[model samples]
Target: MVDIPVELPAGPETVTGDWTVGDREDIVLIAHGAGAGKDHPFLVGLADALGAEGLSTLRFNFPYVEKGRRMPGPAAHAIATWNAVVAWARTQEPSARVWATGKSYGGRMASMAVAEGLVVDGLAYLGYPLHAPGKPEKPRAEHLPVIATPQLFIEGTNDPFIQPLEQFETVVSTCQNARVAWVDGGGHSFEVKGQKRPAAEIGASFARVIAEFIRG
Candidate 1:
């Protein structure tokens, strides 16, 4: 139940994070998806699971969430928020490594930040939206090739955000220290029809995959 204190930039209101820090261990700073906040059940479950694996986690909300908007903030705003979070993470545990990760839009922004030279040890995208559904021609992976940090991208097979599996595989193969984990029969939200598993369980599976990927 440890709180990961953070300081936001002067213009934006201060933000707090729900954090679970592993004993003397490094941390993974995570941002929620477009429709959820830091306390979303899925995020909480993932943080708990990652904590069990001896990895600390810091999950926070974006500015849009702070404003109670259904949509996320602009790309530049998200990147700015991430930049602040990373800066906070570094100060909180100077000796511990800091990793940036997120779900969907959050994840993509983290990648963008990394490509722009925002410092971090690595990255993990719970679901990297390659492109909007029915829009494969406008994929969002061009900058991926330039990012050098170790990265893990977990995605559902049926996610509308990313198209045909073949192309996704090819893109991942081109990035250094990057790999993909597929969640069978999962939609963009990782929901599998008729499967009784709770949202928290699905998130735990993602946490497990990320833990294993980082361990390797």
Candidate 2:
């Protein structure tokens, strides 16, 4: 894994990322959720698993996480960070196809960036927070229909953020290229009910599912 520090266009602060190289010409750029950094165990495990499947991986922290804050910064900053890291990743491997994937908040920001003209081959959401917990009335999916790139949402069956599978289905149906994979009995983090597993194991388990989507 190579350490990469990305400098924002409008600021002096640099966000850190870990680049796990693979033999193939595809790369998955991953970002953390609101509460965690790039080095979180789940991300590390996912990166490793992707690497083993011959897909390079780049996992990075958003600006707020880099600044030691628990709450995420504005969407603009997060999108800028995504842009910077993606730009940097292209420089490292210009021939590789870059795709974006992230947990909850990170995934949402990636979608927003793509909606606002950031280019990517595709997108994968680990656990898309479709709405605030317990409030499905306000779904954050207005941008879903406008995005033309392929999308894969790996959501848990019991994730409160996207309760009532019908709501999520409706959103996906409007997209040009979108699909959803339900994790049976799992929560927002893909943790299954009454099933205890290490963070790494849980993260790695989804590698095959994501790889298949990317390969298609």
Candidate 3:
């Protein structure tokens, strides 16, 4: 476990993280989505799988989640947390390559941070919310094209957040280096209708694809 300090407008806050050491030279720093924290089974399973794959994993919470808030504090705060976590990770194993990834909101924040010049080798999004469901008029993609690092988008074919796949495809097309891995018939959390599976199991399933993307 680690405590990462983030300076928010209100005051300085500390976020918590769990580091699972692996036998590899690459370090994957993961952030939680809007709802969950570092310990969620979904994230835990992913980290555990990464460990088995010999990839170091560090899962951490944003400032808001650390403070027990249901909603994210602010994009700036989340970005600061990303900055802190990445810096901390680099310090721990300066020779290790660092990659950033997270579920939905957490992953989006990472892109924003990278766009704003937070250094990271690459990024992977578990599920990117292209737009609010049914409202593709506005997109949160302006900064994506500016990011030069390799990016991997693991999206579910049936996720409402990216409803109207064509628009999402266009956004990806603009990226400097990005690719998508679609989950056939899966939902936002990779939940396939009529198929019952624990969140951890579902999360763990994505490990191989994500690991491949990282090493690619």
Q: TM-score, each model? A: 0.91, 0.95, 0.97
Go through the candidates in order and give the C-alpha RMSD of each one to the true structure: 2.3, 1.6, 1.0
Give the alpha carbon lDDT tens digit for every residue of 35-129 in model 2: 89988889989989998899988898888887799998789888888888788888988988889999999999999999999999999999999
Q: For model 2, where is the 10-residue window of minimal lDDT?
A: 1-10
Tens digit per residue, CA lDDT, model 1, 118-137:
98888999889998888888
- Quick one: ranking by TM-score, best first? 3, 2, 1
Badly placed stretches (over 4 Å) of model 3 are none
Per-residue accuracy of model 3 over 50-129 as CA lDDT, tens digit each = 88899999999997777788998779999999999999888888988999999999999999999999999999999998
* Cand. 2 Cα-lDDT: 0.88
> What value does the lDDT take at residue 170 in candidate 2?
89
Where does candidate 1 stray beyond 4 Å? Answer: 1-10
lDDT of 2 at 146: 89
Whose lDDT is higher: candidate 1's or candidate 3's? 3
**Distance from true location, Cα of 90 in model 2, Å:** 0.7
lDDT to native, each model: 0.82, 0.88, 0.90
